[model samples]
Target: MSDLLANLPGRHLEAWHYTDLKALKSFAFAAPAPAAIDSALLPDLAMNRIVFVNGFLDEALSVLPAWARLSSHEATKSDLPLAILNAQHRQAGIAIDIPDDVDAGAILLISISQAGAPIALFPRHRISLGRNAKLTLIDIAQGEGVYWHNPVSEISLADAAQLSHYRLQDEAEAAFHTATIFADIAASAAYESFSLVLGGQLSRAEFHARLGGAGADIHLNAAQLLAGTQHADFTSVVSHDAPHCASRQTVKSVLAGHSRGVFQGRIEVARAAQKTDGYQMNQALLLSPHAEIDSKPELEIFADDVKCSHGATIGALDPEQIFYLRSRGIPEPEARAMLIRAFIDEALAPVTHDQARALLERAIEGAWSKLVS
Candidate 1:
């Protein structure tokens, strides 16, 4: 364990060059102790609730729906340091299987961290949707503490399966978070994911997705609202291994105070994967002079017939738009907030779930208030 911690990636690794983890070397993190479940921390949604307190699943608090098959299981091993740490230190996790042709309304999995000391929690989740299955999942990480939350999720979608995933990371101001999602998509499968990052002192959310079969479609969208000294990184890699597959990604960040944001996205199209269509765009809005944003978009295409493109943009809010809003009787702060919200809403346009979209909008509003205050 000590060796793994010692060998963690730093600025040398191209993937983590912008957001280094060197500062964490001084913090000592023990295994998180079991904490009581607080329902108040959970989101107000009409869905099955699965609660994980200090990274351990609380069966007593979980309300399973008819389409969910839940059981205790260990996570798969991975070479990534954080994933290795999760597999080694995870106390409890759940494996959920959705039956074929079932339309599961929604399932909410909430991870809460509450400990007396600065500790670490590893939560693992594995989800598989059978052929023709449809499901919506909302994964949320929220708590009040100075701790490290490392989570890993493995997802597989069978042929024609559809999964809509929404994630919210609203940890405490002092918390550190690192989360990764590995997904394998099959033929005709549609996987859509939207993530919103609002809190945490230092955090990174990553996704590695593979289109394993033809006709598969994937959409990855994210938004980050950072203030104070908060730092957030959104990195992803989408591989098109099968022909006729499509993938799209859009990421946006609104940085204020002395906060920093990073977006690193890569799209790879294999030689055999002809007719592949891929697009990636990352944009950032810096509201303060001290705020910083790093954007990196890469495309590795081996197929000549594929259509692939990547681009990034960074700028501040449009002064003309703010002035126009203010001229209509709106205050300066409110006008700025409105423009910021509009900027983020464009990235979140792909989210189809009404409730999830509303929740994210409210979270953005709350974060904006803090930034403009």
Candidate 2:
């Protein structure tokens, strides 16, 4: 795997890069295995499952479903330090292929049982949805001790195909995680992503999406809850390369204690992307005097005939909304929670699956309860 370290960009720790190389130089590659597996909490999932315990792939706990194809190799293909993580550490990973016109579901569960000082783990994944195929993916990342998880995932959508991605990161208090994801949407294709980040000392998720064909549509929504000194960043760049494409993005963050959150979104409509429509917004709620949030929403349009707009709001909870709920015999804490939940309801409301939506709603409420209680 030393070939992966060939002539490439220098590793730099920037706000945009999200990983510190000095902190990732410790762990020596060992075979992957989970210390324990919680069978009850995990249900039977349709998509292939890849489990990584202690920064290595755990073959025993992973299942490659019949409808998918898997392969593993040590090579650098992406353009960032974090994107080609498995190549750098000689760690094992899986590549998934969904056959044409096939409909299925899969989940990848990655956990770190013991992360020692200066240890970093990278989990690399690739997914391809064939023409008219559909798929749903769930990703969960957890780490123990003071560690770093630099993960990268790429997805390509064929004509009329649809992909839905759901990700949850609940690492240990001392762990730091950064993820980069790229999606290419084809004609009449659709892509949707929903993310929840509740646990991490510092976490960042970056997304790059392109509408490569006409009639493409993409929807991106994320909710982040940070407490204490934790920090979370969500950044996305969406480009419309074809005419008649549409995209929408909305992000909501709740910060308490001394935690900080950042949201950056950019939407571009190219000269060829006439008749394109895109919208983006970022909103935050500060639960403590020390909490802080930074939001940047922007739009660049080269097409003379297009509609695009962006909005951002960073403030505390509404007094009137809290009072209205409190006047209805609700307790002060409960009223505040209710108002905060309402602020996030717009993103959760569009989710069609009851179970998935319920899970996210519960996680959001749990974070609020922890902050207020």
Please name the candidate that would achieve the greatest lDDT relative to the true structure. 1
Provide the lDDT at 12 for model 1: 81
Compared with the true structure, all predictions reach lDDT values of 0.86, 0.74
Using TM-score as the measure, the top candidate is: 1
lDDT per residue for candidate 2 within 1-373, as digits (tens), equals 2333242224354435432233333434233344555554443454467766765566677786765434455454766555655456544455767788988754555455465544556666678889998877777776567766667777889999988787777778877777788898999999988888888887888898999999999988888888898889898989999999999888989888998888889898999999998988889989989998888777889998888888888889888988888889999898887777787777654365555565566667667766766
Which residues of candidate 2, in runs, are more than 4 Å off?
A: 1-48, 73-76, 84-87, 106-113, 116-118
Q: Which stretches of candidate 1 lie over 4 Å from their true place?
A: 1-4, 66-74
Question: Candidate 1: lDDT over CA atoms?
Answer: 0.86
Q: In candidate 1, which residue pairs get closer than 3 Å at backbone N, Cα or C atoms, i.e. clash? A: none
Each prediction's RMSD over C-alphas, in Å, is 1.5, 3.7
TM-score of each: 0.96, 0.86
